[model samples]
Target chain A: MDERERINRLRWRCTRRAMLEMDLLLGEFLERIFPTLGPAQADAFIILADMEDLELWPLINGSRECTDSVQAEVVALLRDVRVK
Target chain B: MSNSSIPVRKFDAVIVGAGGSGLRAAIQLSEGGLKTAVLSKVFPTRSHTVAAQGGVSASLGNSEEDHWHWHMYDTVKGSDWLGDQDAIEYMCRMAPEVVVELEHFGMPFDRTDEGKIYQRPFGGHMSNFGEKPVRRACAAADRTGHAMLHALYQRNVRANTQFFVEWMALDLIRDESGQVLGVIALEMETGEVVAFHAKATIFATGGAGRIYYSSTNAFINTGDGLGMAARAGIALEDMEFWQFHPTGVAGAGVLITEGVRGEGGILRNSDNERFMERYAPNAKDLASRDVVSRAMVTEINEGRGCGPNKDFVLLDITHLDPATIMKRLPGIREISIQFAGIDPIQAPIPVVPTCHYQMGGIPTNYKGQVVAADGVPVKGFYAAGEVACASVHGANRLGTNSLLDLLVFGKSSGDSVIEDLATGKVAHQDLPENFAERTLARLHRLNTQTGGSDVNETRLELQRTMQKHCGVFRFKDMLAEGVAKIVEIEKAVARTEIKDKSQVWNTARVEALELDNLIEVAKATLVSAEARKESRGAHVRDDAPDTAENPNGRDDANWHKHTLWQREGSSLSYKPVTMTPLTVETIALKTRSY
Candidate 1:
């Protein structure tokens, strides 16, 4: 898929959260941070979308420490959005 | 008007909605050696019955001394005298038998020290005739409905009941003589239209809580059966009476079962006081759901609410032992931590009243046959569960009694069908010249339309309008305006368009059709609620307050009858609530207090 097509698909996936709280948190992230993304950051955001809420939630809420370097930047952004 | 166009499947009985009630009914027909087909919009177990967290009430006397008479009295008083006495007596009398039967079907219920089914205290269940709380709700921990639905489904499978998963019933097909033949259903996978011709059609469709924006119902609860029956020129009875569960998680609308309170949890306000002590001095937190919900809402409105917005209360279970919390209400703790972001073992869960169950729908007798009026029965048609008002839960339903209602009525309906068919009197009725005409036209409109109303937007408007105007507290002007606004919204819903024209798993198409059903329920609720000026059970109006002289504001002399709403011209009529019980004297009406 083209880069633009991939980014748009990832953005749509953000809207489809299992939890309503996650919907708002990810939705805010999609609107504010997703557009001004570098290729690496966009790819990092892509992987986070596929993770289940049980895993993805702790990373965003900072309940569990993020060990993976790839997800570190996106997870930090999600945490920022949640606190905001 | 060719009859050979759409595919047709035949069965001795077709049951719509494979929830607790439908599965119970299906097991009976299948075990009776009748060919049965059960259709559901989702998988059988995933049906909303799995979402029921509390126990089913039965006078098992497993935990303490109890009797069916006490159970009957509690239910009658719980319903605010709106419940038909005969139906309530039948349900209460049959409760113990059905619960034991469910146990025999391999339902793993929580047991006492002596290995009897464990019973929990629930709202509106009393001992010695409302003198004290009783342990009558037989539970499998807090997930009684999940255990019950799985056990019933397993039994149906053993009996070889054929199931049509992901199929939605579009409309009830009736013959020229007004006998229900079967249903026109849509196969959700392929978008294929098929008619399930049957000797009997059972609508076990669950609640219509989706009519409100904030609800405890799953997305599949669109009130399909009620809508189909209404469109076929049938009246929906007691549509105004809706039960707002006392403790849905604040802001999330996920249900926090009353089972927690039944297990000795408390409701605290901002003042950190048990406010229910003032509202229902005797029953306290274990009052009927309507009473508890109204108390919570009153607390919020009176500025005693707990949350920052002062819009919610706190359900405190921190006083309970951790082991008891885990053993009795594990699902509640999970729901609280996951949805409300609180651990009930340590902290209180934020809760508010949310639209939970419908106490009314397509009218039926205790035998489960859909009735045109009081005594006029519709042949070959039956309904149970939340979809059919059998008038057992007339104005309000007690906690745990809903599950009991399904077992008692669902089994009885199935047995009645067996008896009816055994006489060799019921056969395949000739289909009207074009039974599928309306369904085909509806689909054609969706496919061929250009720039019609958006499905989601219109549905949101309907929910918001219902929530705003016809909320927990109803106002005279607001309800009148609500009727007009909902009538306007119905026009837009009738024009709801879908973008997805694909014949493959088109959920958009399914959603638009569900909107059609949701609008009917919304209209019926608003129209019936507006006409019923008196406050009775769940349909409480601000204008109708309980004064010193007139307790509960129940205008039995005037509004004692059921509000029947017809979809044809939005017309409404009333039928009297049956007062006489079988072989028992009438219980004198009095102030309905906890």
Candidate 2:
């Protein structure tokens, strides 16, 4: 799929959550930052999307550090993009 | 023309609070061809049920030989024998079926190698008459409740259940003849008040864990249903008994599920001592939650605690393989890292007992019929889940049973309502005159009332007082003082004013209203706790010393019955626990031990 189609596909995945907090954080990342991602960042975003909300929430909250550098950088970008 | 003239809508059944129980009941009701409406303070998925991390208890015998008889014995013993044996028997017997139904409903529970639903050991669960830890808890990678909530919500959606999201029920509409008509609810989006007229009204509004400052409960858990029931002259049973989970993240009361211990984690003191071994030789860390919580408190009190200032213990799971931690306890690892800044794969997490669940609520029967103080079923009213006592958990809830309670009672309650409707038993009572008057007057008072007390400040004080005086260990004087202080707080709450007068999505107004509910719960807990003299289950009294025969100095001879605390004059009554099971022999009361 093309980049736009890929981002749209990932956006749909973000809506499936047991928590709205995760939805907002993941939704904002997809809408604002997904289209701008390169191939490596797109893979990282996919990993982030697949994680459970409890794990993803901390990454978005900047409380815990992710072990993977790629996931870490993408999560940091999402954190920066979030309106404080 | 006035607030009393709010529009009224009708449904066959109206369920308040769209968490697991409410959604499960909605699914059943809707599938049964009943027009059901589920009102939730937040979106259905956002209810506090999603925060539950451990598994649901059931004698599935998936991993080993287990029976509902054994489950009943453990639950009754876990409640310190204060639980009604009949209700306990019903819940235990219904466990396996309810769990299987949830699995069939597409709940993504972890599977054994044979593809059966996975099970794990939890505190107070045993096999062969408490001989060993049994894998009784049906799990989905420590996110059982989340999976269950999602599955039930999906099922409800497929069943075409109508959801009134972000709508808070203000009061129960009772007729002069003492039958519940339905409820007056506020729509948060438009700030419009509406009345739900139904043949039956079910309250599944979860627990009041937020009565304490440090609790695993979400902010939305303000005991709205309990408050409404109490105001409508229903009794809150055994309000003294609140479960304190042993492994809450230190300083942050978010839960670290006992599933950690069930997965081979250990609790250690500063000397690296497994203290639970000293307390409960067999179950150790897997003892009843009340026992484990009391042990932790005792360890901290004796200055054998692990963390700095010796105020907390350590939940050590570093011995577990990293992969197992990753797969089974991913949520615990994340919470430990974020809240306590410790990863289970590397180091121990600082932990302390935190307010987790309420073992008390509006008294109900096994069939989800809300009963009056005299043990008569309130016509047209029902309750299930954590909000209703049913005198099942009694004084202390066993871990994992809370979710199981929700499933069994929620489904049974829905079926009961269906039966009532089909049999033409539920009378279509007309809306009584001035039904909306009290509800509208209260809303108007909050909206137009000027400043006297701030909502947030009074709420904080209420939480602080409950946390300080009515905590894991209570004393006679402290509890007495707590009762008086709660009475004062109630007065202050009544005078509280809403600062923000915005009609649409005004959270300040909601908080002010929720504070009223929280205060009601706080008073019920403190006052009821003060009245119960003996230490029993989660209602441990510091002044009561343990004897050679009685564990926790539980005075079963005098205090075995359920405390029914009503709002009228804050009067306290007692109801005898039905000791006889339906078919099996009664599990005779013994000095409860792990």
Candidate 3:
């Protein structure tokens, strides 16, 4: 699939969290943060997508920070987008 | 063609709920060459099973020297000696195999440094029969159930098992000879009513935890299978015993898994004292759910509760390493911050006892065949998971055993169905002419009924009444009053009207239908709880005095047998517990204390 199709699929997955709180947070992140990412960052976004909402939610909440630089940057982006 | 003349769809086997158990069974049946159909009220992934945060129990001996026999002993004791030994032995023995099967199916189980499955200690899991806490819970970082359900769903998809998402089963269709024909269900998207005619029917529709106002169950866990079985003249076994998890987030009632305690989390009161150490000195924070819940409630009652209202206690994990918290209990951290707005790594999460699991359900044998009060199997009918009382978890289920029960019994039932089908003995029983009429009429009544009482109001009233009377603690006067009040609420439920006229994707209509089941479960729980004179396991009664032998005030002499609730005139009966296992010495009953 092309980049647009991949992003759309990722958006669909974001809305399907097991917990409703994660659903809202991830949905917001996709809508606001997806358009600003380059190809490598999009790949990093997919890596973050692979993690369960349980892991991803905390990274964005700043309660637990991600060690990986790519994941750390995505988490920062998500937090930034949430504040905006 | 008119909608009334909808043709029936045929399958070799039909499974309800599509959660872990239903999907597991569907995988087996489809792989066995049976045309299987799984009908679920929500998308398969969105089932209530996804909310389970702890690991599945297995004596894999990965983290410690553990054995199934020792696990069996803890389970029997945890159940307060009410669980059938034969089924307990079977489940404990199959735990390792099934957990391994899940691993082989690409379930993301956490691993130790040796590359074997990582095991965590859970409440009531011991090594050498009450020696010490044993590492038996095979985890996937507090998302074991999520991984297990996804793995099973994937396997079912591979096996080509047909799925009917967003379809709610209205009633069980039975022939005149009392054999299960299939079920009549409502397709939520189009509001079309359809019939599934199968040679065999399985009810894996989970528990009725939603009956209680403060529960960890999802909105969909209305005990639909139990309601259908009871309405179809099947006796619900042991409906009174409800497990109350001690660590639900205070106000929200969302679950904080027992894995938290397993990973060294402690329960503290308002005075900053570790209170479980007072109740259970040996097990401390890792006592069985019932023991811990009672301790928490007692602390709150004694004016030691935390928070402004003093209604809840604190679960402290701030002492644990931040890396460990993030790696092992990430979900709990997320849940705490999201639900309670408190992060466990920084501050303690406020929690209280919440209704978690139902030990009683549609009465079934160890083989998963639904049995009547006479101990005879209902032909072509089966049950598994939380909906079925295979009598494995007896009065209080040990943590992680719920997921294990789903896998072991789910697969057993599927195998039994395949064997029965291979014999060509249980052919498709013909449905009566008006089989679908009753179910259709129920839908019609809900679809067209004007205002009498709001659906949400009636449901909330039932929840409040249940929470008030039938809670962690019970007394004679309170239980009797609860029974009477529930009966009055039944009328309120009957008079409840569904104002949503649209048939397509009408959520109001769905809630209305679900309330029908919830009321049945609530009534059964209250009535059965009131009738049981003694406190056993989760059914702790304040009025019942402690016996010399039984420290918990459990009167096993009169109430040792399971209580069976039959819907015909709403009566009760008793069935003997199968104490003898297939090939092991009976674990003799003893006064249970942590």
DockQ winner between candidates 2 and 3: 3
Tell me the spans in candidate 2 whose CA falls farther than 4 Å from its real position. Answer: A1-84, B1-4, B256-337, B340-351
In model 1, state the lDDT of residue B87. 92
Residues B438-465, model 3: lDDT tens digits:
6777777766677667888888889877
Candidate 2 structure lDDT? 0.84
Q: Where does candidate 3 stray beyond 4 Å?
A: A1-84, B1-4, B256-292, B295-351
Candidate 1 per-residue C-alpha lDDT over B167-268 given as tens digits, one digit per residue, 9 for 90 to 100: 889999998888999999988656788999999999998888888876777666789998899999889999998878778887667777778999999999
- The per-model lDDT (C-alpha) reads 0.85, 0.84, 0.84
Evaluate residue B252 in candidate 3 and report its C-alpha lDDT on the 0 to 100 scale: 61
- Per-model chain B TM-scores are 0.89, 0.89, 0.89
Report lDDT (Cα) of residue B185, candidate 2: 92
Shift in Å, residue B245, candidate 2: 2.0
Clashing pairs in 2: none
What does candidate 1's lDDT look like per residue over A1-84, in tens digits? Answer: 545444444543454333334545666688788888787887788788766455687686566887677689888877666312
Model 3 vs. true fold: TM: 0.83
Give the CAPRI rating of model 3.
Answer: incorrect
DockQ, each predicted model:
0.07, 0.10, 0.11
lDDT of 3: 0.84
Residue pairs in steric clash, candidate 3? none
